[model samples]
Target: MISSVERVRAAYARIAQVDRPEVWIGLRPQEDVEADAASVDARAASGERLPLAGTVFAVKGNIDVAGLPTTAGCPSYAYRPEADAPVVARLRAAGAVVLGTTNLDQFATGLVGTRSPYGAVRNALDPAYVSGGSSSGSAVAVALGIADFALGTDTAGSGRVPAAFNGIVGLKPTRGLVPVEGVVPACASLDCVTVFARTLPEAERALALMAAPSGRELPALEQRRPGPWRIAVPRPERLGELEEGWAEAFGSAAARLAEAGAELLEVDPTPFIEAAAMLYEGAFVAERYTAVGTFVDGHAGSADLDPTVAGIISRARDVPAHRFYADLERLSALRTRALTALGDTDALLLPTTPGHPTLADVEADPLGANARLGRFTNSTNLFDLAAVAVPAGEVNGLPFGVMVIGQAFTDERLVRIAGLLAAPPVRLVVVGAHLSGQPLNGQLLSLGGRLVRTTTTASAYRLYALETVPPKPGLVRAEEGGAAIEAEVWQLPPEGLGALVAALPRPMALGSVELADGSFVTGFLCEPAALDGAREITSYGGWRAALPSLAALPSPAALPSLVRTEGPGLSPPRT
Candidate 1:
């Protein structure tokens, strides 16, 4: 396997080969990245468990990364942060190495990626299209494989829009679920640190790490159980205007989800549309002003600001304080109405953007194109909901994406659903110690595994109680007359299989195991020699059922290997 350091070096080489300068505003020196990777390697050598060990990542320029200057996509507004943003710090602690800072829409004020003076961030797949912003570069970096994942800020669909344009996963966590300290504010109260990655599990891993510290005083997030999900979407007429092929794209995506077993229902979108309009058309415009109004006022009529962004922030000054308060009242009522509309649905599915516009299209009518892109997304943060943007399919070779929105704290549920929609996962049948709730289950979860269902193997196997410390179970194929054995089937990331298989203890190997349904999946199997004199517990059906008697015996520490081997049927230890 290539070491993490080699991967980082190769990523930088790829970036150099492509030479897309506009995708990044600043990058750590090669030596700096090497140093970070070296530190992660040293930690691994010291036996530390780093969830993101050797993972390379980037940050949207607005979020601080100690040695990098945070420009928020405006050169004049740049400032060198003395420390990393809390999100960055958390990711670093988890062993992710920082590659650099990426470009964005100036001050995070637009959905089109062209507002930065640093230069327009072109689409990763095509140079003629807009990359979407203010997370344009972050999304492009991930799409181009320059980084494993990246951090972006989402105030008004910045994170999600870019993700759609780049065919990547954009996770806009529930507001305040990730601390915003040390990040350059876009709309302060509405701003959320977002994650951009190529897969749902990668995004989920980053979200979990960033969410840990901020969850202290927050309401406990509900753990999502796997089952058939009910998905809500806007009624056809209310889906608003979409680009030429986008409506069909969305319809096809909805149909596929239905075929995959999700129950799809249409709901009136009036409240959500009204709430979305309030973000800029209502008094919430002032929030943008509050974040960077002073700077705009100070730099008024200067060439430092992007005209579109300048015009947007300049309008905030006209919104009176009383208007802001009234809008807040209106928003609260709308939120209640929106929640009522959602009812029992697990999540709301929508097009991430109405269209993917070209650079010329955005330049000709910047505000109109940007507004259309945010039609389905602007309401999410305003309503304090969590959303994930996932690539749905392609329209005439261009990427089309669907946004999965859920009520507050349902981040994990959204990712789980997104994963199912994106691709078929690697299913593994886990028995014995690796079953759910067993001591070794963490190994599966840490490798991005999700429990699919509990089932029993076909009646060709026998279960034996292993006399190892911690007392694991071993399943062996029988020549004749064996009982069915219970097992848990888990879906794991295919890329993690090699490492997982490499870590298995003696006698345990991955092999085809047939389930009661007559289907087969790769699962744990023990060598026949390992089960010679082990106690047969096939009648119990599963490890959980036999756990009680095992728990009642003298602890493994109190009983030596000799005592365990003294029984009548016990065989001598093998070399």
Candidate 2:
């Protein structure tokens, strides 16, 4: 493990090397940050299991840090909180050093990063593009290698949009899940504390820490909804607004998900689209106004305030109370329809944003372009859904992404789906001792191997009883006469397969094995030389059947001391 003090210094060094000054609004003194890191190292050295030890994180400025002023991107409205937000406190307790507060759209108002008074947060990939907001700085921080993860609030795509732009993982968890008590809410009721990380597992790790009960800890292995997943996607007709390469990019992403074992189903995009419009076009702005409009109004005409943010909030003051109720009623109905459309589907997959917009694109028509960025994101919080956005592929040379939105409490489901999307599971064929309930089955079990199913190899291999220590079988391709041989198909992560390969004993190796179904998989195979003087057990069809032949056999080469003769009672060789 890296020392936390070194991690802290490395993060500061990265921040200094990056050109985007707007990515951070306030950075805690390096010495102070290093002191916190040293403490984490001390605890870890003393035998404490600090999950986040040596990890660095950045907090969105809207969320309060004990010493840094909560600017919410408006300097005049800044306030120094005496204590860290409950969410921040939880992360700190877990041993993550708070590097500093990052920039965001003022009061988390816009999807476009340009609304911040500090300056537009530039995309880490290419400065010409807008770093999506109001979580822009947080995403950029992770993308720039400054922090392992960063905390951002998501009311409407604030967490996810920036992640797409920066090619990172953004997790906007179930609403009301992460405590938002100390966050400067954009739409208080809809806001969720989200995390931006370079990868999904890291985001899951950090968010798991924040969302676990005060006393109820998260399980070591998260519960995952297994695939083949039933996934829903928007109807093609409704995607007219996607930029030139985005539609194709999304199509490719969906195709890849299908290949990863997700069953794709098309759903009308109407309900979700309409709900998204309501976030800004309907009465939801009333929530935003209620959240921070008072301050914006009081500081009216101040050049320090972002005018677009002021105007957006200012207009909500005219919305009748009845209008807010009516919209709520409308949203209630839309949630039902949206959920219904997504019925039985493990997740709803969509482009993270319609397109990647340039910094100039936002500058030219800030409101319009910003609204478009939330086209697929706004309805998420409104519908009370959990979402995980991950880098998909590039479009027109710019990074593109897809979001897997799932029902509340399906955060782990999204994680699973995203993981498959990131790295498809590998199939491995196991035979002989590696079969379920067999002597060496525990090896695969300890490697996180999942049984896909029991099957048989093609009628082209011969099974032989090798005179090895444990009396193992050697499977070899028959020159002419052969029959199907029983084997089990297993699934494993790519890394697990690699580990298994590296640990295989001599004479046993992995090679292409044809299945009875005309399919091929990487499976356990033995060198032909191993069967030179071995007893052919081909008629038995499988190792399990041939085991009866070795019922009275001793572990000759393995343990000569324990070898028994005709003497009846002896610790029999493991069957």
Candidate 3:
């Protein structure tokens, strides 16, 4: 595998020569990137770990990554920040090194990436095609694998449209799930930090790391599993400005969902669409002006900013305060209608972007093309929903993806579903608390799952003491015939198993192992080899009883609130 650092250096080498098309507004020094690479190498050699170790990533110009200037794609508006935004801080903590800040529509005002004065960020797949913006370069960076993932701000599809245009995964997390403290907001209430990654897993990994704690408790993982999920689809008449092949691909995808046992329900998305319009078409545009009004006013004569972007900001100055508040009220009402449309559904399915437009086409009709791209994305923050875009198929040699939208705080659920949608299904047996109704069982259920059987491992395994803080037992398959250990079988939906697997701690993994009934289930297998000289505890059965008792375990009140760091067995909420 190419280390993310190597990929960044490779991209830099290519970008250094005629960097115009990729459009980096805030390129980092080659020396800084090399130093980060050295750090990654040192950490790996020293046995220090990182979930995103050696991974290279980028952020849209609006986000504050320490040492990078916050330009929002306008040179006159640029300013160096003293600290990384919370999202960037989190990613750094997880071991991902920043590549550089990318180009975007000035002040993130345009959906098409061409509005930047630095240079238009071209589509990664083809220079002739437009990279959707205002987070265009962020999307292209990930699409071309220059970075493992890129951070973009989504206040009107700046985060999502570009991913679709570039053929990558765009994760527009639930608004507020990722904080916006350091972002140059296009619409403060609707602005969300989004992630772009080549794969759903990579995107989810980045989301988990960057998401801040919301302080609200999540519904137990098992409780989140709606028994039979309803997946909402827009009524055919409502699919707007769609490309030819997108309709076919979406229909085929829906059929696959039906075949896979989802209850596909057709819904009138007019209310949702109406709500989406509130973002830009209504007074919400005033929020955009509010985000950077002072700067725009101070630099009124700057030729560096895009004229269209400056015009939009200038127009916002005329809106009265009452109109902005009225828009907020209207948006609230629309949110209620939108939520009703998604009621009881596990996810609402739609095309990631209505269609892709070429650079020439976007340049010819900027505003019209931009509005067309937001057809599916404008309502996310307005309705407080979490969403992820997973690649589905292709059209005219360009990749197309499906957007899975779910209720807020259901980010993990969407990821699990996205993973299933992305990869082929696998059958595996689970043991211990992973079984239905068990403490850690929700992880499986959230992915649309069910119990296959209650079984046992083959008579060649010894369960032992593993160093989990809530110390757990690990089963080691032995060549010499050993005692049959108890376990359970699970029938997981094709994309339903990731949320749980992704939560496992270090030294634990999903492995092929025998069951008590002389069968195999993809169950929890431990690196008991890491438990050398540790106590053998197979006689007490599984971790539930063999491990320490919950009664004697420290009460929530007694224990210091240890942030559930990302890894296996931890499902800490993303902010």
Candidate 4:
């Protein structure tokens, strides 16, 4: 088993190997990490509970950490804080150690990660590629395994874009879910604290700890199998700036979901797109200026802020008071439109980044590029949704992620669903009463089972309605004349097989079952000669439907329901 401390150490080594991404101005001293590790070890020996227990993480420079300087990526505005921000305090109490502060678009102004004065954070996988920002450093740190997780702020796509580009998980919790007390404001109304991690489980654990612990009971986490998943896609007319290859990747991902039993529903994503436009194009850009205008003006002579960031923040100084009110009114109406568009879907899937841009690519059109980066992300906080970015696939080896946005407060449910959708694991085909929603399903569900694509085994096995204590289905491999049977493949952790096998009823056992793809898995295999006058239920493609429907026909109880179909078992087809 891999320990979190070992994971953190590997990440630190990777961060030390390369020149650190220009996204950070400094790092925690080596002596500090050593001391922290010692304390963690002592606690482990003493059996004291440590919530995070040696997990290493980073904070965006703008959020204060005791004894560290708060620069917000702008040196002129740097100030040492006497205490950790509230969010940091909570995480530290949970046993997470802060490694250092990361660089960002100065004052968290730009969406593109390149506007920082320290140095542009390069993509973790490919150096030439620009790391998405203003959460650039945090995303890179997690992507390169520098920390188990890191904290960043998402005013626009700062939290999400970087995760998409670097092949990591970025979670933007509902605004106000994690209080923003002590963090610098970058459009405070829409600003949200974000977390970046390599895996959904790790990210989700951290999210639970960081969320403001409330006494109110949250709904039980919902876990719907992959089939029946309904996703609302962007209206074809609203997709903008998607690169050629990216368009194909999105389509292919959707196709994969369909294969896994999901229903892809296309809805007009125009209202959300229209709301996204309001973030920067309306008065919200002025809010960015409001947060840091005085500093920019006071330090005009000494500040080395990116000229482009400075230019946009300066726009705040020119907005007429009345126009601000008018913009607010329009925004309210747009929010309603957004809610209607998102209704009736598990999540609204969108390209993490419409497209990727390079350092040189962004420098040429900083403003235009930054605006484009937020095309799909700007409305997240504006409309108030919790989202997680997962690595969907790749284009030319660079990562492309999909954002699963759900209604606010359903954050936990979203994470559970995201875990199910992660890359498929070892398949375990079940050919009997163990199907989902069946009595034996509790056994599989207890073992962290995830439904993989559901399908029937090739016609080469025999099924016998086994007469057992609870009445079960017996699937057995047969020679030349076996009929193809119905079954569903599920994924489970390799270590969890023992418990499942131990719970099997007598007569009906676990063995290899051949799937349509000629693959095999641990599934239902029956005893020999169990089939006598058993009525075949081969017409129904799956065990659940076939068995129940067969019960209704003639022998209902007398007619043993047996069919020549693939019997559930975990054995590769005889090739």
lDDT by residue (5-94, candidate 2, tens digit) is 866766665565445688989988999999999999999999998899878899999999999999999999999999999999999999
How accurate locally, in lDDT, is each candidate? 0.82, 0.82, 0.73, 0.73
TM-score for candidate 1, residues paired by index: 0.73
Q: For residue 530, give model 1's deviation from the true position in Å.
A: 44
Q: Where in model 2 is the C-alpha error above 4 Å?
A: 214-227, 424-575
- Assess every candidate by TM-score: 0.73, 0.72, 0.71, 0.71
Sort the predicted structures by lDDT, highest score first. Answer: 2, 1, 3, 4
TM-score for predicted model 2 compared with the true structure: 0.72
TM-score of decoy 3:
0.71
Over 4 Å off in model 3, which ranges?
1-8, 11-21, 215-226, 424-575
Per-candidate total of colliding backbone pairs: 0, 0, 19, 24
Question: Candidate 2 at residue 510, lDDT?
Answer: 88
RMSD after CA superposition, every candidate = 14.9, 16.5, 14.8, 16.1
lDDT comparing candidate 3 with the true structure: 0.73
Which ranges of candidate 1 are over 4 A from the true structure?
213-227, 425-575
